[model samples]
Target: MSAPAPIPDRHGRAGRNRPGSRVWLFAVPGMTLFAAFWLLPMLRLVGVGASGPSGAMAYLAVVTNRHYLWSLVSTLLLSAAVTVVTLAISSLVGLFLQRNRFPGKSLLLAMLTFPLAFPGVVVGFMVIMLAGRQGLIGALTDKLFGESLVFAYSLAGLFLGYLYFSIPRVILTVIAAAEKLDPALEEAARSLGANPLRVFFDIVVPALTPALISSGAICFATSIGAFGTAFTLATNIDVLPMAIYNEFTSYANFAMAASLSIVLGIITWIALALARSLSGNSVPATA
Candidate 1:
């Protein structure tokens, strides 16, 4: 008897290839790209971080050393504040925009989301124009209170810059999530004699909780890593981003900068991971 014929491929080749033998070929490009773009760069960064005078101990200085630790702490606090304020304001505005219909509503929403199109540097510049020495607030305050109020080049300015970008980001996320909510749940809560506040807190807030959490995490991460705005406004302050910039540029401490960068990346990754895990899905973070 003739030997059994081999299985034919789609092209009608006489014999079939071992099913999984060449699967590794499919992964080559992906692995190569990953290694070239992500893995190799990361490994190189690690090596650089360890290339300092103190060697691998420079990474530990991020938390153990006083100056670096203070910078990290300040950045954490600032980012937390920005995230909370952004979420609070965005939640209200997003809910109102989603629930109500009024003249110019579309225009108002367009204006609100317009900042999403602005880069970090542009947002920082806008903040400066609003809070700078010659800005609108300074002019208004000078006339009203006999002082040209200026905080745009300080921590306050940094906070405002963070909020400027953060608000639009969280607003977009909140609005998207809010639109998907069921009005029936809210109406039912009210039908049972729950007051508007109760309905809001119990029904609306709960429904929007996931969005809020994820968006807040994104905002926090952005604020922590933000540099352009901080550079424009935080002339007298220090955040992690600014610290890294100073280390890299001003002091030319590449190793220290790399270590700080790694630390910042770790914290940002943790925030993103928590957001993903708690929201039960991956939430894309807008810059």
Candidate 2:
């Protein structure tokens, strides 16, 4: 039998050799940075927790510890609450912005996105000033309601503080999706005898699902890993991040902290995976 002929080059060697074809070169630097800073550290963390003859046993003990479990539960609950609240408020705001033209709409949009530019620490401080007992709103509410609605150093306070930072992120994500939507879709549904409420449920809301999932995942991840906000808003509230911080810094338990950090990383990764899966299956009502 004759030897098999060499495979023909696709796109020709010339095309492959073009200067722009070296785009992969640009990715090298980013990949190098990511591998060094993020990927390597994450691997080291997981490795340290799961390595050695006793490492698995040690990690199991940490994971099964009642205190650690409680901290994880509290963090998840708080993150979920923040995610839901952010989604609700952002969806409404995004829908309003998409459907209406208002005076100072541009200014409002700018202000809404302004929080993204601030450091998390600064945002936490702002929340404390606005909602703490001595703050204006807190004082005013106390005077009117005869009860102090102090938000600082409490779980409720932490939730509200997270909301202040998270809502803006959700709004931006949802609004981008909303802008891509065709208003005519809703109008056509109304013309077809669907009521406004039915049209919203049947058409508008479904179109926003992908955006909502994306935003919720982001908010969930941010809330779970938040350090500055938790530190400032509720030092007494022990969440997973706080637990990890204490284990590493206060108790000097590097192994335990690394184990907890790995757990948090895995949880965030699972959330992101779920979001991607949901987004992949979601169909835009506009189309």
Candidate 3:
């Protein structure tokens, strides 16, 4: 029998005769930029931390510190709450826009997404003005209820700020998913005597799970890493990002900050990975 022919390389050339041309042209600039802006800076920061006894010990100390752990726990709790609220609100809004005909629907969606255009710091300031002790809603609530409903400088403030950013993201993602869903499935459920609630729970909700997961993951990651809003609004509260900042700038402890950053990065990665995994599993495989 004749020997099997050698497999062609990427350009359909034989192994030894492959072109010497650079195949990394597309990747070269991006990799270079990434290294320059991200990877190199990260390495330098880590090196700075590793080089000093105070830095390294501070990092270890912060990681094992109960205060740091509590801050992380608080941050996660706040992030989760915000994600849940944003997901629920955005999903409902998307369903309304996609399925029901309402007046000024486009206008409403545009308004909902307007927050995405605002900087987080600006959003935080606006929220504080609206919900602070002397602000509109807070003043009204205080006058009517004889108690301040001021949410500024608290976990609630942070959550509200996160929701402001996250809701728009959720709306955009879920609306796209909603648009792709076949309305016939919903109609069939209705024809089978399924109530609106039952159809929504059994059919619509299941279909939108992947989008919800994705939006939640995005919201969670952003909330955990958020600095602007947390700095502006939640000064009284100690969230993870704020703690990291304090460790880095106020205390001048780069090692502790690095350690905290690594922890935050790990958490974000895990949440995103879980979201992707869940989305992949939920999506039906096509031929």
Candidate 4:
């Protein structure tokens, strides 16, 4: 048999390049961007962290210093609380909205998700308006018990604000995931004598685990790094972000600020990393 004709250069001259070279070509821009934006900044941050009065051990102050350590702990706890509460509320609302039909359902959903449009500061202000000293709750309590129920400048207010801001995004994620769940699986579970709770835990929860992991990670990261809401409502609390701000702005301690920032970033990274490892998917570094 005659030799087959040479294959046509369907992918063009560039396509004739080696696979490794092609990969480098495609990857160079992204790698360059990553280095410029992410890697360089992180390295500089590390350097700054080490440039403190204590030298390279400056980052240790995040744990060694009582105030800084407490701030870090409080931040982690708040972020975890926000993640759990947001997941719980979002899951319920998402499921109900997805499975049930009622009057003005669209309107209700739109209203529920309207918080997504508001910034963190706006959410804090809303919290203040609802629970601040002169807010509705305060007025009601004062009217009923002769005591104002003010909490808008404390950790409680920060919690409420974070929850409010986190719920909308999480609800959207849960709703999207809920819509894709197979009703047949739920039905099959019921057919097999599984009760509502059983079916939910066995079928629905498993199916939605990935979404929950991803969204919870995002919520945690957001809460960890959130500055605006904390700035607006953290009179009694010392969250890490606010601590970093105080260090950098109020105390003019660039080294402490950089160290705190690195510590904060490391904690956030660990949370996302764990979620990704468990969920087998990519998670965003920042919310």
Evaluated with lDDT, which candidate comes out highest?
Answer: 4
Per-residue alpha-carbon lDDT of candidate 4 for residues 1-287, written as tens digits (9 for 90 to 100): 98544443656433333435456688889999999999999999999989888887778888898999999999989889889999999999999999999999999999998988988889889998999988999999999999999999998899999999899899999999999999999999899999999999999999999999999999999999999999988778799999999989999999999999988888889988999888877655796
- Once fitted onto the true fold, the runs of candidate 1 whose alpha carbons sit more than 4 angstroms away are 1-31, 282-287
lDDT tens per residue, model 2, 200-247: 889978988988998899899999999988877655688988889888
TM-score of each: 0.87, 0.85, 0.86, 0.90
Which wins on lDDT, candidate 1 or candidate 4? 4
Cα error, residue 52 of model 1, in Å, equals 1.3
Q: Between 2 and 3, whose TM-score is larger?
A: 3
* Clashes per candidate (backbone, < 3 Å): 0, 0, 0, 0
- Lowest lDDT block of 10, candidate 4: 12-21
lDDT of each: 0.89, 0.84, 0.85, 0.90
Q: What order do candidates take by lDDT, descending?
A: 4, 1, 3, 2
What would the per-residue lDDT of candidate 1 be over residues 49-86, giving only the tens digit for each residue?
99989999999999998999999999999999889889
Better of 2 and 4 by TM-score: 4
Which candidate, 2 or 4, would have the higher lDDT against the true structure? Answer: 4
Location of the lowest summed lDDT over 10 successive residues in candidate 3: 14-23
Error of 4 at 251 (Å): 0.9
Best by TM-score, which number? Answer: 4
* Candidate 4 runs further than 4 Å off: 1-23, 282-287
